[model samples]
Structure formats: structure tokens, C-alpha cells
Target: MNIFEFIRDPSQIGPWFHQLLLSAGMQEWVANLIGDVIGVLLIVGAVLTSAIFLIWLERKIAARLQDRVGPNRAGPYGLLQTLADIVKLLTKEDVTPDGADRVSFNLAPALMVMQIIMVAAIIPISAGLIGANLSVGLLYFIAMSGIASIGALMAGWASNNKYALLGGFRVVAQLLSYEIPLAFSLLAAVIWTGTMATNNLAMQQGELLFGFIPGWNILVMPFAALIFFIATLAEGERAPFDLLEAESEIVAGPNIEYSGLKFAWFYLQFFVNSLLLACIFTTVFLGGWQGPFVDQFPLLGIVYFFVKSLLVLLALMWVRATYPRLRIDQMMTFCWKVLVPVTLVVVLIVAIGARITPDRSINAVIISGANIVALLVTLGIIGRSLRRDVQRRKAALPGRSTAQV
Candidate 1:
């Protein structure tokens, strides 16, 4: 391929590189092995490098929300602040508590980072651009993402500290509870799309509904998108669903006993996982790499994909800046009572809608209309519940009259 061809279609670069390796007198198997290693390294490097920028971006965003200057000294617009922090962390002494389980304590951070990386392998960046376009990519993601909680639990339990152990318990309660709603939300999309392959999901979304509207899952199943977004906040341990690491309660949670590079790994995992979840949301709901002129200029798909993912990431950060962390009881209650039931109803709606027609546009319209009704009904129910709870509280108060209540 020529420079312009590769420029217009970056997917060709991978195959071209492999071919180049073969032309360099390498055996087929050796070339394949080398290609695989390069792919893995590139993915890992991209994720880790992106975390640096994400960290700074989040700090700047949070700072602006709080009306303060953020990270302006280290580099232009404080771009190097995360790098400076990395240096400081590297120079700090690595510490493990005396009573901590040596193996588990050390393994936890690596495990957490590794699980996130594994999930990244399946994320479709653009058309023909993914580490592994597995047939069951969505299922693979759901499975691998769950492993991070195990790492958290291991860290908490092995820390040999009471507070850390409590954090571990919270991790179990929070992650496990949210995973159900998360999975169900994704299930709604799967039912509607009839595919679990990430690339196929994106490809299917490329078509415009009614010749104008983007055939994104978010439009067809808004409730699923909302539920998925909320569930991911909890899944990623972002506020207000950040009950696992509520510093006031658990004293830095599972990673309390970790310091230096070990702690940095946990920290890196958080930012990177948040970005990955946003990428997943973009792919599954926002029409990954689907945009105007994408067919004519395939490289534009990469641009479109990241732009959508960035918006999702900004939304996630906005929520973190706006909401206070929820209490453990409240967090669990919201997941089980609200998110879970709503997601189940969404799945049911999609399932019924899909059975109504073989035409995708018709199915989308049916599902979208049903989603509107479900959302309104859900909001009304929630409002009524809140009002009743307020009235009961007023009725119990000695100073409150029935009229006032």
C-alpha cells in the first residue's frame, strides 16, 4: 500500500507491518508471534499513556467545576502535571504492611491493571481496527471487567488491616450489585442489535434510521443507555457510586496499605478503566466509528470513535465533579431497587419490540416509543415514592400538622 492508502485506511498498517516482517525473512509462525506481541504492547502502551492525559484532564475539569486553577505550572496548560506526579510516586518508597499477605498484597495491583488491559483488547477502535475482534466480544468484556473486583477484594483482604477488610467487603457489595444491572442493560442492546461482536455492533449502527436519524442504541433504548451509564459509574468506582473507596469511612479502602508504585498501579487502573468503559459505551450505544463520510474516508471513523468516547468520558467526569459519594446503604439500594428493575424492564421491552418486526427501523421505532413510556412511568413512580416518604416523615414529627405534612 502507498502512503495515501495507509493514511486513508489505517487498518491496512497492521497487515502491512506483518507482511513487512515476513519479507524480512521471518518464518510465518515467528512473524505471527512478533505481530501479536507488538499488538499487545501497542494496546498496553496506548492505555497507560492515555491515563496520563486523562488524569490531567480530570483534574483540570474538577478544578474548573470548583473554580480553581489546575496544574498550570508543570507544562503548557499543566499538561505535564501527571508526569510530575508519576516521578514523585516513582521516587517514593514502596511499602507493604508487616502483617500483610506478601503474595496477595503484591499481586492485587498487577491483577487489577491486567484485567483492565485484557478488556481493552476487545474494544473496537474503528472499522477493522481492534486488538481482537472476538465473536463474543461483549461477553468477553463483561467477564474480564468483573475480575477487577476480585483484585480489589484480594487487596483489601490481604492488607491485614480492619479498614482495608471493610473496604473489601464494600467492593463485593457494590461491584456485585451493580454488575447485574450493567449486564442487563447491555443485554437490552444485544437483544435489539442481535449481535454480541463489538465490531458488528458498530457496523450495524452505521445505518441511518428513517433515512436521517443515526441508528444508535441510545435512541432505540434510552433507558438502557441511562441504566448502563449509571451502572458503569458504580462499576468503575466513580462518584456518586464510589462507595468502595470512601476515604472517610475506609481510610483509603483496599489500597490503604499500598504505597509508591503499587498504589500508582491502582490509581492508574481507575482512570484507564473509566476511559475503557466510556469507549465501550461509545461502541455499544453511541455508534462507534459511525459518522458522515466514513465509508468514503475510513480514517474518519477513528476520529469519530475517539470523539464520541471523549464526550462520554467528559460526561463521566462531570458526574464525578457534581455528585457527592453515596452512602453504602443508598448505593446498594439504588442498584438493586432502581437500576436493576429498570434494566430488566428495558430488556423486556427490547425483546418484545424485536419480535414485532424483522425490519430494524420498525423495531427501533417500537422500542424507542416504549422506552419513552417506561421512562415517564419510572420517573412518576420515583417522584411519588419520594413524596410519600416526605409525608411520612412530617407525620412523625411533633411540630408538623397534617395539612403541612
Candidate 2:
């Protein structure tokens, strides 16, 4: 393809590069290997570059929410602040604690970053544009994504600090607890679409529902979307659910002992993972790469995908800025008691709805209606429970009367 054609259909860039290598008299296997390496490099580069930008973006977002200026002195509107931080981190002395396990202490941060890259590999950026379009992409993502918890454990345990170890324990608890609802939420989407491939999930969402609304999973499975988003906030260790790194309690969490570039890896992984999860959420629910006229101009898909992902990321930032951190008990209780049960019900309802109809639009409408009713019921139950707790607290007060309570 020529430049203009490639511009219109960026998805073909991979194949085009492969062909270009072939035209240079390279062997087929060699060309394929080179192409794959280049693809991996590109994915890594994109992720790392985005992490730098997101760091600044998040700081600015938080500053705006808090009514303050953030990173203004480093560069124009603080655009260069993250770059300066990167330089400082690189120049800092690399210090592995005197009693630390050298191997695992060094390995943990790289592993943390590696897992995020692995999950990103299967994500479809646009039509036919993915590093590895595995058939069981969703399952692969889930398996690979869990490696972060292992990394956190490694960091905490290998550091030999009590607080770090506690942070590790919290990571295990928080990630494992939320993974259930996260998996169930994705299961709802799988049941509705009858596929677990990430690309297929996005492709299925390309059509228009009833010839008007975008056929995004979020529209039909709002409960699943809500559950998935909430579980994701906990999984990513954003505020409120950020018990893993509750600096107030655990100092700096799993990577507390890390310094210099070692610390930067964990720091980079935080922002990168948040963005990746938002991308995954967009792919599964918000219709990744599906936009108007995208068929005619495939490059627009990338724009649509990133715009949706950014909005999700911004929502995450807003939550981080707005809410106070939850107590460990409260976090766990919300997950096991609230998110898990609600997600299960959402999955069952979706399964029934999908099985009841062959037409997607019909199924969507039915499922959407069912989701609304389920939401109302869930809210009513939660409200009633909260009222009872308040009443009980009032009754237990020494000088409280029924009227005052």
C-alpha cells in the first residue's frame, strides 16, 4: 500500500512492513521474526511513552480537582515535568537494602512492567491491529494480568520489611478478591457475545443497536459494566480501594524499599496498568475501535479507542481525587459482600437474556431492562441495610432517644 492508502487503513501497516522486508530479499521466516520483534517494541514504546504523558496528565487533573497548580515550573503547563522526574530517577543511586534478596528485589519491578505489556499484546487497537490476536485472548489477559500480584508479593517479601510484607499480603487479598467480580463481569460479556476473543468482542460491538444507538456492551449490560469498572478501580489500586499502598499505614507498600530506577519501574507500572485496564474496559464494553465511518477510514478507529480509554482514565482520576481511602475492612466487605454478589446476578441475568433471543438487538433490550430492575433492587437492599446500621448505632448510644436517633 502507498502512504495515503496506509494512512486510510493503518491496520495494514503490519502486513505492509512485512512485505517491505520481503522486498529487501529477506527470507520469509526472518521477515516474520523481525516484524514480530518490531511489533513488540512498538507496543512497549507506546506503553512507556503513554505512561510519561499520563503521569503529568494525572497530576494536572488532580491539581485541578484540588484547586492548585501542578508541575507548572518544569515546562509549559508542566508538559516536561515527567521527563525531568525520569532524569532524576535515572541519576539517583541504585540501592538494594543491605539485607534484601538481591535477585528478587531487582526482578520484581521488571515483572510488574512485563505483565502489563503481556496483557497489552492481545488488545486490539484497531481492525486487525494487535500484537498477538490469540483466540483465547480474554483468558490470556486474565492470566497475565495476575502476574502483578506476584510481582508485588516478590517486592514485599524480598524486601524483608514488615510493612512491605503487609503490603504484599494486602495486594494478594485485594487483587484476588476483586478478580472474581472482574472475571464475572467479563463473563457476562462473553455469554452475550458467545466469544472470549478480545478482538471479536470489539468487532461484535461495531453494529448499531436498533439502527441508532451504538451496540456497546455497556448499553445492554450496564450492571456488568458498573461492576467491572468498580472492580477495576480496586484492582488498579486507585483511591478508596488503594489499601495496598495506604502510605499512611504501610509507608509505601510493596515497593517501599525500592529506590532509583527500581522504584521507577513500579511507578511506571502503576500508570501504565491503569491505562491498560481502561483500554481493556473500552474494548469489552465501550466498543474499542468502533466508530462512525471507521470502515471507510480505519485510522479513525485508533482515535476512537484512545479517546474512550482516556475518558475512562479521567473517570478513574476523578474518583482518586474525590474519595477518601477506604479502611481495609471496608474494601474487603464491599468486594465480597457487594460487588461479587451483584456481578454474579448480572452474569446469570445476561446468560438468560442471551439464551432467550437470537437477535442481538432484542437480547440487548431485554437484558438492559433486566439490568435496570436488578440495579433498583440492589440499591433498595443496600439502602435498607445502611438505615438499619444507622438505627442500631443510634440505639446503642448512651443518651440517645428513638426520636433523636
lDDT of 2: 0.91
* Model 2 misplacement above 4 A: 400-405
Model 1, 203: alpha-carbon shift in Å?
0.6
TM-score of each: 0.97, 0.97
lDDT of 2 by residue, 8-104 (tens): 9988888888888999999999999999998889999988888899999999999999898888988899999999999999999998887999999
Q: Write the per-residue lDDT of candidate 1 for residues 1-405, one digit (tens) a residue.
A: 799998898888889998999999999999999999999999999988888999999999989987899889998999999999999999999888988999999999999999889999988887989999998988898898678889999999999999998998888788888889888989998987889999999999988888899999999998889999998898888999887788888778888999999999999999999999999999999999999998888899999999999999999999998999888888887788888888889899999998898887888999999999999999999899989988888868969776665
Error of 1 at 304 (Å): 0.7
Question: Model 2 misses residue 162 by how many Å?
Answer: 0.3
Question: In model 2, which residue pairs have backbone atoms overlapping below 3 Å?
Answer: none
